[model samples]
Target: MKRIESIKNPKVKEWRKLHKRKDRDLTGTFFIEGFHLVEEGLKDKEMVNEIIITEEVSIPQHWKLDGINLTFVTTEIMKVISETETPQGIAAVCKQKLAVHPLNWSKTLMIDAIQDPGNLGTLIRTADAAGIDGVLLGDGTVDVYNGKTIRASQGSIFHIPIMKGAIGKWLPSFSERKVPVYGTALEGGEPFNKIKSSKDFALIVGNEGSGVQQDLLKNTAANLYIPIYGEAESLNVAIAAGILLYHLRE
Candidate 1:
Protein backbone atom coordinates (compact mmCIF):
# COMPACT_ATOMS: atom_id res chain seq x y z
CA MET A 1 0.00 0.00 0.00
CA LYS A 2 1.39 3.40 -0.97
CA ARG A 3 0.39 5.47 2.04
CA ILE A 4 0.00 9.25 1.97
CA GLU A 5 -0.12 11.51 5.01
CA SER A 6 0.45 15.11 3.95
CA ILE A 7 -2.56 17.21 3.01
CA LYS A 8 -0.39 18.85 0.35
CA ASN A 9 0.78 15.58 -1.22
CA PRO A 10 0.79 15.45 -5.02
CA LYS A 11 -1.74 12.63 -4.98
CA VAL A 12 -4.08 14.95 -3.11
CA LYS A 13 -3.96 17.33 -6.04
CA GLU A 14 -4.90 14.50 -8.39
CA TRP A 15 -7.68 13.38 -6.06
CA ARG A 16 -9.04 16.91 -5.71
CA LYS A 17 -9.31 17.24 -9.48
CA LEU A 18 -12.03 14.57 -9.28
CA HIS A 19 -14.31 17.13 -7.62
CA LYS A 20 -15.23 18.57 -11.03
CA ARG A 21 -17.14 17.03 -13.95
CA LYS A 22 -14.36 17.80 -16.40
CA ASP A 23 -11.75 15.86 -14.45
CA ARG A 24 -14.09 12.88 -14.05
CA ASP A 25 -14.49 12.87 -17.82
CA LEU A 26 -10.80 13.43 -18.49
CA THR A 27 -9.72 10.61 -16.21
CA GLY A 28 -12.63 8.32 -17.18
CA THR A 29 -13.21 7.85 -13.45
CA PHE A 30 -15.46 9.25 -10.66
CA PHE A 31 -15.20 9.20 -6.92
CA ILE A 32 -17.74 7.63 -4.52
CA GLU A 33 -17.80 8.85 -0.94
CA GLY A 34 -18.35 6.66 2.15
CA PHE A 35 -17.96 2.92 2.65
CA HIS A 36 -21.40 1.90 1.37
CA LEU A 37 -20.93 3.35 -2.13
CA VAL A 38 -17.43 1.91 -2.33
CA GLU A 39 -18.95 -1.43 -1.36
CA GLU A 40 -21.67 -0.89 -3.97
CA GLY A 41 -19.12 -0.34 -6.75
CA LEU A 42 -17.28 -3.44 -5.55
CA LYS A 43 -20.46 -5.51 -5.88
CA ASP A 44 -20.96 -4.35 -9.49
CA LYS A 45 -17.55 -5.97 -10.28
CA GLU A 46 -16.92 -4.24 -13.63
CA MET A 47 -16.81 -0.49 -12.86
CA VAL A 48 -14.32 0.18 -10.08
CA ASN A 49 -10.84 1.54 -10.89
CA GLU A 50 -9.25 2.16 -7.50
CA ILE A 51 -10.10 1.93 -3.82
CA ILE A 52 -8.68 4.55 -1.42
CA ILE A 53 -8.62 3.73 2.24
CA THR A 54 -7.37 5.38 5.44
CA GLU A 55 -6.22 4.13 8.88
CA GLU A 56 -9.73 4.56 10.30
CA VAL A 57 -11.53 1.91 8.31
CA SER A 58 -13.00 -1.60 8.16
CA ILE A 59 -12.92 -4.05 5.26
CA PRO A 60 -15.68 -6.53 4.71
CA GLN A 61 -14.65 -10.18 4.49
CA HIS A 62 -16.58 -10.70 1.24
CA TRP A 63 -15.12 -7.84 -0.87
CA LYS A 64 -13.03 -10.00 -3.18
CA LEU A 65 -9.97 -8.12 -4.44
CA ASP A 66 -7.88 -10.34 -6.65
CA GLY A 67 -6.98 -7.67 -9.28
CA ILE A 68 -8.43 -4.48 -7.78
CA ASN A 69 -6.11 -1.52 -7.18
CA LEU A 70 -5.99 -0.33 -3.56
CA THR A 71 -4.51 2.93 -2.27
CA PHE A 72 -3.88 3.94 1.29
CA VAL A 73 -3.96 7.46 2.82
CA THR A 74 -3.67 9.00 6.24
CA THR A 75 -6.74 10.62 7.85
CA GLU A 76 -5.45 14.11 7.05
CA ILE A 77 -4.93 13.22 3.42
CA MET A 78 -8.35 11.60 3.24
CA LYS A 79 -10.00 14.73 4.68
CA VAL A 80 -8.45 16.98 2.08
CA ILE A 81 -9.70 14.71 -0.73
CA SER A 82 -13.19 14.07 0.66
CA GLU A 83 -16.33 15.64 -0.91
CA THR A 84 -18.57 15.42 2.13
CA GLU A 85 -18.75 18.00 4.92
CA THR A 86 -17.84 15.21 7.32
CA PRO A 87 -15.42 12.80 5.70
CA GLN A 88 -16.38 9.17 6.14
CA GLY A 89 -12.73 7.97 6.06
CA ILE A 90 -13.14 6.16 2.74
CA ALA A 91 -13.83 6.90 -0.94
CA ALA A 92 -13.19 4.98 -4.17
CA VAL A 93 -12.41 6.17 -7.66
CA CYS A 94 -14.33 4.20 -10.31
CA LYS A 95 -14.27 4.11 -14.08
CA GLN A 96 -17.28 5.45 -15.95
CA LYS A 97 -18.72 2.37 -17.62
CA LEU A 98 -20.25 2.55 -21.08
CA ALA A 99 -23.83 3.78 -21.25
CA VAL A 100 -26.49 1.23 -22.17
CA HIS A 101 -27.40 1.64 -25.81
CA PRO A 102 -30.87 2.71 -26.87
CA LEU A 103 -31.53 -0.59 -28.66
CA ASN A 104 -30.89 -2.34 -25.38
CA TRP A 105 -33.38 -0.12 -23.57
CA SER A 106 -36.66 -1.68 -22.51
CA LYS A 107 -38.79 -0.21 -19.72
CA THR A 108 -36.71 2.80 -18.72
CA LEU A 109 -36.98 6.33 -17.36
CA MET A 110 -35.53 9.41 -19.06
CA ILE A 111 -34.55 12.38 -16.90
CA ASP A 112 -34.69 15.70 -18.75
CA ALA A 113 -32.46 18.53 -17.66
CA ILE A 114 -32.88 18.02 -13.95
CA GLN A 115 -30.44 20.25 -12.01
CA ASP A 116 -30.52 18.61 -8.60
CA PRO A 117 -27.87 16.00 -7.89
CA GLY A 118 -29.78 14.69 -4.88
CA ASN A 119 -32.98 14.39 -6.89
CA LEU A 120 -31.19 12.64 -9.71
CA GLY A 121 -29.57 10.19 -7.31
CA THR A 122 -32.84 9.50 -5.49
CA LEU A 123 -34.62 8.87 -8.76
CA ILE A 124 -31.89 6.45 -9.81
CA ARG A 125 -32.31 4.60 -6.54
CA THR A 126 -36.08 4.48 -7.04
CA ALA A 127 -35.68 3.28 -10.61
CA ASP A 128 -33.49 0.42 -9.43
CA ALA A 129 -36.06 -0.45 -6.79
CA ALA A 130 -38.86 -0.52 -9.37
CA GLY A 131 -36.80 -2.67 -11.71
CA ILE A 132 -36.71 -0.04 -14.44
CA ASP A 133 -34.32 -1.02 -17.21
CA GLY A 134 -32.16 2.13 -17.09
CA VAL A 135 -32.02 5.94 -16.76
CA LEU A 136 -31.20 8.38 -19.54
CA LEU A 137 -29.48 11.54 -18.25
CA GLY A 138 -30.58 14.19 -20.69
CA ASP A 139 -28.93 17.53 -21.38
CA GLY A 140 -28.97 19.97 -18.42
CA THR A 141 -29.05 17.18 -15.85
CA VAL A 142 -26.34 17.32 -13.19
CA ASP A 143 -23.32 15.10 -13.62
CA VAL A 144 -23.94 11.49 -12.63
CA TYR A 145 -20.27 11.36 -11.71
CA ASN A 146 -20.72 13.98 -8.98
CA GLY A 147 -19.60 12.63 -5.59
CA LYS A 148 -22.81 13.85 -3.91
CA THR A 149 -24.85 12.04 -6.52
CA ILE A 150 -22.92 8.86 -5.84
CA ARG A 151 -23.38 9.18 -2.08
CA ALA A 152 -27.11 9.92 -2.40
CA SER A 153 -27.60 6.92 -4.68
CA GLN A 154 -26.54 4.59 -1.88
CA GLY A 155 -25.72 1.29 -3.65
CA SER A 156 -28.50 1.67 -6.21
CA ILE A 157 -26.48 3.55 -8.85
CA PHE A 158 -24.60 0.39 -9.85
CA HIS A 159 -27.76 -1.68 -10.20
CA ILE A 160 -29.23 0.65 -12.84
CA PRO A 161 -27.61 1.46 -16.18
CA ILE A 162 -27.49 5.21 -17.05
CA MET A 163 -27.13 6.87 -20.44
CA LYS A 164 -26.48 10.58 -21.00
CA GLY A 165 -27.34 12.82 -24.00
CA ALA A 166 -29.88 15.12 -25.58
CA ILE A 167 -33.21 13.40 -24.92
CA GLY A 168 -35.25 15.58 -27.29
CA LYS A 169 -33.23 14.47 -30.27
CA TRP A 170 -32.62 10.87 -29.17
CA LEU A 171 -36.24 10.01 -28.25
CA PRO A 172 -37.52 9.87 -31.80
CA SER A 173 -35.46 6.73 -32.28
CA PHE A 174 -37.53 5.11 -29.57
CA SER A 175 -40.62 6.27 -31.36
CA GLU A 176 -39.37 4.57 -34.52
CA ARG A 177 -39.01 1.37 -32.52
CA LYS A 178 -42.67 1.78 -31.44
CA VAL A 179 -41.87 2.08 -27.76
CA PRO A 180 -44.28 4.32 -25.82
CA VAL A 181 -42.69 7.54 -24.57
CA TYR A 182 -44.40 9.07 -21.54
CA GLY A 183 -43.77 12.58 -20.30
CA THR A 184 -45.03 14.20 -17.11
CA ALA A 185 -46.60 17.63 -17.10
CA LEU A 186 -48.68 19.85 -14.83
CA GLU A 187 -51.45 19.98 -17.41
CA GLY A 188 -52.94 17.95 -20.27
CA GLY A 189 -51.84 14.71 -18.62
CA GLU A 190 -53.28 11.35 -17.66
CA PRO A 191 -52.93 9.81 -14.21
CA PHE A 192 -49.90 7.59 -13.73
CA ASN A 193 -52.21 4.64 -12.92
CA LYS A 194 -53.34 4.83 -16.54
CA ILE A 195 -49.91 3.49 -17.56
CA LYS A 196 -50.05 0.03 -19.08
CA SER A 197 -48.52 -2.78 -17.10
CA SER A 198 -46.01 -5.39 -18.37
CA LYS A 199 -45.22 -3.38 -21.45
CA ASP A 200 -42.34 -1.31 -22.83
CA PHE A 201 -42.53 2.37 -21.87
CA ALA A 202 -40.07 5.18 -21.19
CA LEU A 203 -41.03 7.90 -18.71
CA ILE A 204 -39.44 11.33 -19.08
CA VAL A 205 -39.11 13.33 -15.86
CA GLY A 206 -38.36 16.99 -16.26
CA ASN A 207 -36.62 19.66 -14.23
CA GLU A 208 -37.84 20.22 -10.66
CA GLY A 209 -39.20 23.67 -11.55
CA SER A 210 -39.55 23.64 -15.36
CA GLY A 211 -41.29 20.26 -15.66
CA VAL A 212 -40.81 18.45 -18.96
CA GLN A 213 -39.52 20.31 -21.95
CA GLN A 214 -42.31 21.55 -24.21
CA ASP A 215 -40.55 20.28 -27.31
CA LEU A 216 -40.17 16.77 -25.91
CA LEU A 217 -43.63 16.65 -24.37
CA LYS A 218 -45.23 17.82 -27.60
CA ASN A 219 -43.95 14.68 -29.33
CA THR A 220 -44.46 12.13 -26.57
CA ALA A 221 -47.05 9.40 -27.14
CA ALA A 222 -48.39 9.80 -23.63
CA ASN A 223 -48.35 12.49 -20.97
CA LEU A 224 -49.02 11.43 -17.39
CA TYR A 225 -49.37 13.23 -14.06
CA ILE A 226 -49.58 12.23 -10.40
CA PRO A 227 -52.71 13.79 -8.90
CA ILE A 228 -52.53 15.92 -5.79
CA TYR A 229 -55.34 16.31 -3.30
CA GLY A 230 -56.21 18.20 -0.08
CA GLU A 231 -54.88 21.48 -1.42
CA ALA A 232 -51.25 20.35 -1.81
CA GLU A 233 -49.22 21.97 -4.61
CA SER A 234 -46.78 19.54 -6.25
CA LEU A 235 -44.39 16.72 -5.45
CA ASN A 236 -40.64 16.39 -5.62
CA VAL A 237 -39.36 14.97 -8.89
CA ALA A 238 -37.90 11.91 -7.17
CA ILE A 239 -41.08 11.25 -5.20
CA ALA A 240 -43.23 11.74 -8.28
CA ALA A 241 -40.96 9.32 -10.14
CA GLY A 242 -41.25 6.78 -7.33
CA ILE A 243 -45.05 7.05 -7.40
CA LEU A 244 -45.12 6.65 -11.15
CA LEU A 245 -42.63 3.78 -10.99
CA TYR A 246 -44.76 2.02 -8.40
CA HIS A 247 -47.77 2.18 -10.69
CA LEU A 248 -45.76 1.09 -13.69
CA ARG A 249 -44.33 -1.86 -11.77
CA GLU A 250 -47.79 -2.92 -10.67
Candidate 2:
Protein backbone atom coordinates (compact mmCIF):
# COMPACT_ATOMS: atom_id res chain seq x y z
CA MET A 1 0.00 0.00 0.00
CA LYS A 2 1.18 3.51 -0.75
CA ARG A 3 1.72 5.65 2.36
CA ILE A 4 1.00 9.36 2.66
CA GLU A 5 2.13 11.28 5.76
CA SER A 6 1.96 14.91 4.71
CA ILE A 7 -1.30 16.84 4.81
CA LYS A 8 -0.01 18.92 1.90
CA ASN A 9 0.39 15.91 -0.41
CA PRO A 10 -1.48 16.46 -3.68
CA LYS A 11 -3.50 13.27 -3.23
CA VAL A 12 -4.36 14.31 0.35
CA LYS A 13 -5.57 17.66 -0.98
CA GLU A 14 -7.85 15.81 -3.44
CA TRP A 15 -9.30 13.61 -0.69
CA ARG A 16 -9.97 16.67 1.48
CA LYS A 17 -11.77 18.33 -1.41
CA LEU A 18 -14.30 15.49 -1.46
CA HIS A 19 -15.84 17.05 1.65
CA LYS A 20 -17.34 19.87 -0.39
CA ARG A 21 -20.46 19.37 -2.52
CA LYS A 22 -19.01 21.35 -5.40
CA ASP A 23 -15.78 19.36 -5.38
CA ARG A 24 -17.65 16.08 -5.09
CA ASP A 25 -19.73 17.02 -8.10
CA LEU A 26 -16.69 18.20 -10.04
CA THR A 27 -14.81 14.97 -9.41
CA GLY A 28 -17.84 12.62 -9.52
CA THR A 29 -16.87 11.21 -6.13
CA PHE A 30 -17.67 11.52 -2.42
CA PHE A 31 -15.85 10.55 0.75
CA ILE A 32 -17.31 7.99 3.17
CA GLU A 33 -15.86 7.04 6.52
CA GLY A 34 -16.20 4.27 9.16
CA PHE A 35 -16.16 0.48 8.93
CA HIS A 36 -19.86 -0.12 8.14
CA LEU A 37 -19.96 2.44 5.30
CA VAL A 38 -16.67 1.17 3.87
CA GLU A 39 -18.07 -2.36 3.92
CA GLU A 40 -21.23 -1.18 2.19
CA GLY A 41 -19.20 0.66 -0.47
CA LEU A 42 -17.16 -2.49 -1.07
CA LYS A 43 -20.30 -4.49 -1.89
CA ASP A 44 -20.18 -2.68 -5.26
CA LYS A 45 -16.45 -2.53 -5.48
CA GLU A 46 -16.47 -0.95 -8.90
CA MET A 47 -17.91 2.23 -7.41
CA VAL A 48 -15.14 2.44 -4.83
CA ASN A 49 -12.12 4.31 -6.19
CA GLU A 50 -9.80 4.09 -3.21
CA ILE A 51 -9.67 3.15 0.47
CA ILE A 52 -7.57 5.11 3.00
CA ILE A 53 -6.62 3.83 6.42
CA THR A 54 -4.34 4.95 9.21
CA GLU A 55 -1.10 3.05 9.33
CA GLU A 56 -2.03 1.31 12.59
CA VAL A 57 -5.36 -0.03 11.36
CA SER A 58 -5.45 -3.31 9.44
CA ILE A 59 -7.86 -4.22 6.68
CA PRO A 60 -10.19 -7.06 7.65
CA GLN A 61 -8.76 -10.35 6.42
CA HIS A 62 -11.99 -11.49 4.80
CA TRP A 63 -12.46 -8.34 2.70
CA LYS A 64 -11.56 -9.01 -0.94
CA LEU A 65 -9.13 -6.33 -2.13
CA ASP A 66 -7.89 -7.94 -5.35
CA GLY A 67 -8.22 -4.92 -7.63
CA ILE A 68 -8.93 -2.17 -5.12
CA ASN A 69 -6.45 0.62 -4.37
CA LEU A 70 -5.37 0.95 -0.75
CA THR A 71 -3.56 3.80 0.95
CA PHE A 72 -2.04 4.14 4.39
CA VAL A 73 -1.94 7.53 6.02
CA THR A 74 -0.72 8.91 9.30
CA THR A 75 -3.20 9.63 12.13
CA GLU A 76 -2.85 13.37 11.47
CA ILE A 77 -3.73 12.90 7.82
CA MET A 78 -6.76 10.76 8.65
CA LYS A 79 -8.02 13.52 10.94
CA VAL A 80 -7.77 16.05 8.11
CA ILE A 81 -9.96 13.92 5.83
CA SER A 82 -12.47 12.60 8.35
CA GLU A 83 -15.88 14.22 8.89
CA THR A 84 -16.53 12.69 12.32
CA GLU A 85 -15.53 14.19 15.67
CA THR A 86 -13.12 11.31 16.14
CA PRO A 87 -11.63 9.76 13.04
CA GLN A 88 -12.57 6.10 12.44
CA GLY A 89 -9.08 5.36 11.08
CA ILE A 90 -10.57 4.32 7.72
CA ALA A 91 -12.37 6.05 4.86
CA ALA A 92 -12.99 5.68 1.15
CA VAL A 93 -13.49 7.84 -1.93
CA CYS A 94 -16.47 6.55 -3.96
CA LYS A 95 -18.15 7.39 -7.22
CA GLN A 96 -21.75 8.53 -6.92
CA LYS A 97 -24.24 5.91 -8.25
CA LEU A 98 -27.12 8.20 -9.14
CA ALA A 99 -29.92 6.83 -11.32
CA VAL A 100 -30.05 8.47 -14.75
CA HIS A 101 -33.53 7.47 -15.90
CA PRO A 102 -36.93 7.85 -14.34
CA LEU A 103 -37.80 4.99 -11.99
CA ASN A 104 -40.31 2.44 -13.24
CA TRP A 105 -41.18 0.86 -9.92
CA SER A 106 -44.29 0.07 -7.92
CA LYS A 107 -43.59 2.47 -5.08
CA THR A 108 -41.62 5.73 -5.07
CA LEU A 109 -40.84 8.46 -2.53
CA MET A 110 -40.39 11.98 -3.84
CA ILE A 111 -38.68 14.55 -1.61
CA ASP A 112 -39.35 18.25 -2.22
CA ALA A 113 -37.00 20.84 -0.75
CA ILE A 114 -36.02 18.97 2.41
CA GLN A 115 -32.96 20.92 3.57
CA ASP A 116 -31.79 18.97 6.58
CA PRO A 117 -29.02 16.52 5.75
CA GLY A 118 -29.86 14.18 8.65
CA ASN A 119 -33.55 14.19 7.76
CA LEU A 120 -32.76 13.53 4.12
CA GLY A 121 -30.57 10.58 5.05
CA THR A 122 -33.18 9.16 7.41
CA LEU A 123 -35.81 9.47 4.69
CA ILE A 124 -33.62 7.53 2.27
CA ARG A 125 -32.95 4.84 4.90
CA THR A 126 -36.66 4.53 5.66
CA ALA A 127 -37.59 4.33 1.99
CA ASP A 128 -35.11 1.52 1.53
CA ALA A 129 -36.52 -0.30 4.56
CA ALA A 130 -40.09 0.10 3.28
CA GLY A 131 -39.05 -1.44 -0.04
CA ILE A 132 -39.76 1.69 -2.02
CA ASP A 133 -38.55 1.29 -5.59
CA GLY A 134 -36.56 4.50 -5.70
CA VAL A 135 -36.12 7.97 -4.14
CA LEU A 136 -36.46 11.10 -6.22
CA LEU A 137 -34.87 14.18 -4.66
CA GLY A 138 -36.50 17.35 -5.86
CA ASP A 139 -34.83 20.70 -6.37
CA GLY A 140 -33.87 22.59 -3.18
CA THR A 141 -33.30 19.30 -1.31
CA VAL A 142 -29.96 18.88 0.42
CA ASP A 143 -27.26 17.04 -1.48
CA VAL A 144 -27.52 13.25 -0.98
CA TYR A 145 -23.76 12.95 -0.71
CA ASN A 146 -23.52 15.31 2.28
CA GLY A 147 -21.50 13.58 4.96
CA LYS A 148 -24.23 13.90 7.57
CA THR A 149 -26.77 12.55 5.09
CA ILE A 150 -24.58 9.61 4.19
CA ARG A 151 -23.89 8.82 7.85
CA ALA A 152 -27.55 9.15 8.77
CA SER A 153 -28.48 6.69 6.01
CA GLN A 154 -26.52 3.97 7.83
CA GLY A 155 -25.46 2.41 4.51
CA SER A 156 -28.95 2.25 2.95
CA ILE A 157 -27.79 4.92 0.48
CA PHE A 158 -25.83 2.16 -1.18
CA HIS A 159 -28.81 -0.21 -1.27
CA ILE A 160 -31.34 1.90 -3.22
CA PRO A 161 -31.66 3.96 -6.39
CA ILE A 162 -31.65 7.76 -5.90
CA MET A 163 -32.21 10.43 -8.49
CA LYS A 164 -31.98 14.24 -8.28
CA GLY A 165 -33.94 16.76 -10.36
CA ALA A 166 -36.77 19.21 -10.36
CA ILE A 167 -39.90 17.55 -8.92
CA GLY A 168 -42.04 19.22 -11.61
CA LYS A 169 -40.22 17.58 -14.53
CA TRP A 170 -40.92 14.05 -13.27
CA LEU A 171 -44.65 14.56 -12.66
CA PRO A 172 -45.65 14.33 -16.32
CA SER A 173 -43.79 11.07 -16.70
CA PHE A 174 -45.66 9.64 -13.72
CA SER A 175 -48.89 10.90 -15.24
CA GLU A 176 -48.11 9.37 -18.60
CA ARG A 177 -47.64 6.04 -16.92
CA LYS A 178 -50.93 6.49 -15.00
CA VAL A 179 -49.11 6.12 -11.70
CA PRO A 180 -50.99 7.84 -8.88
CA VAL A 181 -48.92 10.53 -7.18
CA TYR A 182 -49.91 11.59 -3.66
CA GLY A 183 -48.72 14.66 -1.76
CA THR A 184 -48.81 15.26 2.01
CA ALA A 185 -50.60 18.33 3.37
CA LEU A 186 -53.00 19.16 6.19
CA GLU A 187 -55.38 21.30 4.16
CA GLY A 188 -57.52 20.23 1.24
CA GLY A 189 -56.17 16.74 1.80
CA GLU A 190 -57.65 13.40 2.75
CA PRO A 191 -56.62 11.32 5.75
CA PHE A 192 -53.80 9.06 4.50
CA ASN A 193 -55.51 5.78 5.33
CA LYS A 194 -58.71 6.83 3.51
CA ILE A 195 -56.86 6.75 0.19
CA LYS A 196 -56.78 3.21 -1.15
CA SER A 197 -53.23 1.85 -1.29
CA SER A 198 -52.17 0.41 -4.61
CA LYS A 199 -49.49 -1.80 -6.12
CA ASP A 200 -48.11 1.22 -7.98
CA PHE A 201 -48.04 4.80 -6.70
CA ALA A 202 -45.73 7.70 -5.80
CA LEU A 203 -45.72 9.72 -2.56
CA ILE A 204 -44.33 13.24 -2.25
CA VAL A 205 -43.18 14.49 1.17
CA GLY A 206 -42.03 18.07 1.28
CA ASN A 207 -40.01 20.65 3.17
CA GLU A 208 -39.54 20.46 6.95
CA GLY A 209 -41.93 23.34 7.65
CA SER A 210 -44.00 24.16 4.53
CA GLY A 211 -45.14 20.67 3.44
CA VAL A 212 -45.34 20.03 -0.31
CA GLN A 213 -45.43 22.99 -2.66
CA GLN A 214 -48.93 24.15 -3.61
CA ASP A 215 -48.29 23.76 -7.32
CA LEU A 216 -46.88 20.27 -6.81
CA LEU A 217 -49.79 19.25 -4.59
CA LYS A 218 -52.22 20.43 -7.26
CA ASN A 219 -50.65 17.92 -9.64
CA THR A 220 -50.94 14.93 -7.29
CA ALA A 221 -53.87 12.51 -7.60
CA ALA A 222 -54.80 13.51 -4.03
CA ASN A 223 -53.22 15.26 -1.11
CA LEU A 224 -52.89 13.31 2.17
CA TYR A 225 -52.32 14.18 5.83
CA ILE A 226 -51.75 11.89 8.79
CA PRO A 227 -54.29 12.57 11.53
CA ILE A 228 -52.83 14.24 14.59
CA TYR A 229 -54.54 13.21 17.83
CA GLY A 230 -52.46 15.02 20.47
CA GLU A 231 -51.63 18.60 21.24
CA ALA A 232 -48.52 18.35 19.12
CA GLU A 233 -48.82 20.51 16.01
CA SER A 234 -47.18 18.21 13.43
CA LEU A 235 -44.87 15.33 12.61
CA ASN A 236 -41.23 15.57 11.68
CA VAL A 237 -40.96 15.17 7.92
CA ALA A 238 -38.91 11.99 8.16
CA ILE A 239 -41.32 10.28 10.61
CA ALA A 240 -44.28 11.27 8.49
CA ALA A 241 -42.55 9.84 5.42
CA GLY A 242 -41.95 6.53 7.23
CA ILE A 243 -45.63 6.20 8.17
CA LEU A 244 -46.91 7.03 4.70
CA LEU A 245 -44.34 4.92 2.85
CA TYR A 246 -45.08 1.70 4.77
CA HIS A 247 -48.82 2.30 4.58
CA LEU A 248 -48.76 3.05 0.86
CA ARG A 249 -46.61 -0.01 0.18
CA GLU A 250 -49.12 -2.23 2.01
The estimated TM-scores of all candidates read: 0.94, 0.97
Go through the candidates in order and give each one's C-alpha lDDT.
0.84, 0.92
Clashes of each: 0, 0
Model 2: runs farther than 4 Å from truth? none
Best by TM-score: 2
Best by lDDT: 2
TM-score of 2: 0.97
lDDT of 1: 0.84
Kindly give the stretch of ten consecutive residues in candidate 1 with the minimal lDDT sum.
97-106
Q: After superposing candidate 1, which stretches have Cα over 4 Å from the reference?
A: none
Candidate 1 local lDDT, 103-207, one digit each (tens):
667788999988988998899999998889888889899998787677678878888888887898778788888888889997898887777765677889999
